[model samples]
Target: MPTKPTREQWLRHVLSSATLTDAIKVTATELFLEMRANLHVSVPRALLARRLGRSERQVSRRIQVLKESGFLDVIETGWKGRTAVYVGMFKSRGSDAQRVTVSSTLCEAPKRHPLEKPVPVVAGHRVTPWASRHITIGHLRHGVCRNVSTDADASMLEHVPSLDGHAWRSRTAARLTFSARSAWPLLRDTHARLAAHLHLRLRPVAAHHSTAARKRTTP
Candidate 1:
């Protein structure tokens, strides 16, 4: 009798199979990895969702695809609060000739789209286009000031003075300092702007009256 293919061999075959979609192949790979690591073929949908960074519903759909594709067989059905058990099918069914046909089909390379442009290569490495790799100032500004509390704080940090220049430049060091003396004016200006924007009434303080009251009460 022929020797049975090991789990690793089976996984390699499944991954290379052209009949299966990329999503199904990924799900199968995850399941195989789980089985190898844990010595069990039970993987919860929730676990798969977290591992794959997909919704549970999407994971369920992918699992269903694997089941329908004959890569996975349901050993035991899930019950209340219990996950289902599955066993991976590795051995090819039918005669040697039929197996050869299946193998050839699985090993066939996927066809490329006619309209798709070839990726640019530089020194054996693929170079991504500038447009795709570029990060806009708006994105950088948003990322830096995302944690800022107020609109005034956002406005102050939105655009760096150096970055606004005609020539593009990179800074080695950038620092922003705030002392009471410097920050007080900015705070007062912001308060005034906010008050004017909101049409808020400002109550005047009676500093002279308070000073006179303090003098009268003094020892």
Candidate 2:
């Protein structure tokens, strides 16, 4: 039977990992939690490294660790003029009930995404813990990833066709792609409440290339 998670278990589950089995991942997870608590936007890797007292390379590696471990990851990468913008992944509470206590056994198998069965990967990361690979948390959901699939589009369209992963059509009801499901009812409730409060469930909604273009066509 599955075990209940305590606050520490949950934190550790999102923190310690195989690739980032060191101090960097630990600190990055702390930073992510703090950022989540404070709602910080993408501030750049250098700035984050400075704040964490680590080198930029260290921060970068650990961020990858955080991403693979399902704590934090990237949402979008784009350029405004010659400058690029990357939307940082921070687990924002959706509803009060959406947040649950962590358990003691963190290394235990993570439950499947509440909405999905058991997908090997999602976004760009492998979700299968036994697959001998590591994927980022961003690839799981947005903030809180319960499950992952090789194709987010396939995962999202369990109930209907996903419009051929044509991001534009898939953009609708983005967050709900991994909504509360039978996988973890208790955690789902906690997540729903947590997301409602933090205003971000798994991840934030997908970003549009241009807001004007979004309105010019039907999604």
**Highest lDDT, which number?**
1
* Alpha-carbon RMSD, each predicted model: 22.6, 35.8
Residue 92 in candidate 2, Cα distance off native in Å: 19
What stretches of model 1 exceed 4 Å from their correct place? 36-40, 91-219
Tens digits of per-residue lDDT, candidate 1, 121-175, equal 6654243422222233343333332223444333443344434211212220122
Model 2 misplaced stretches (Cα beyond 4 Å): 1-10, 16-19, 37-41, 78-219
My TM-score estimates for the predictions, one after another, are 0.39, 0.27
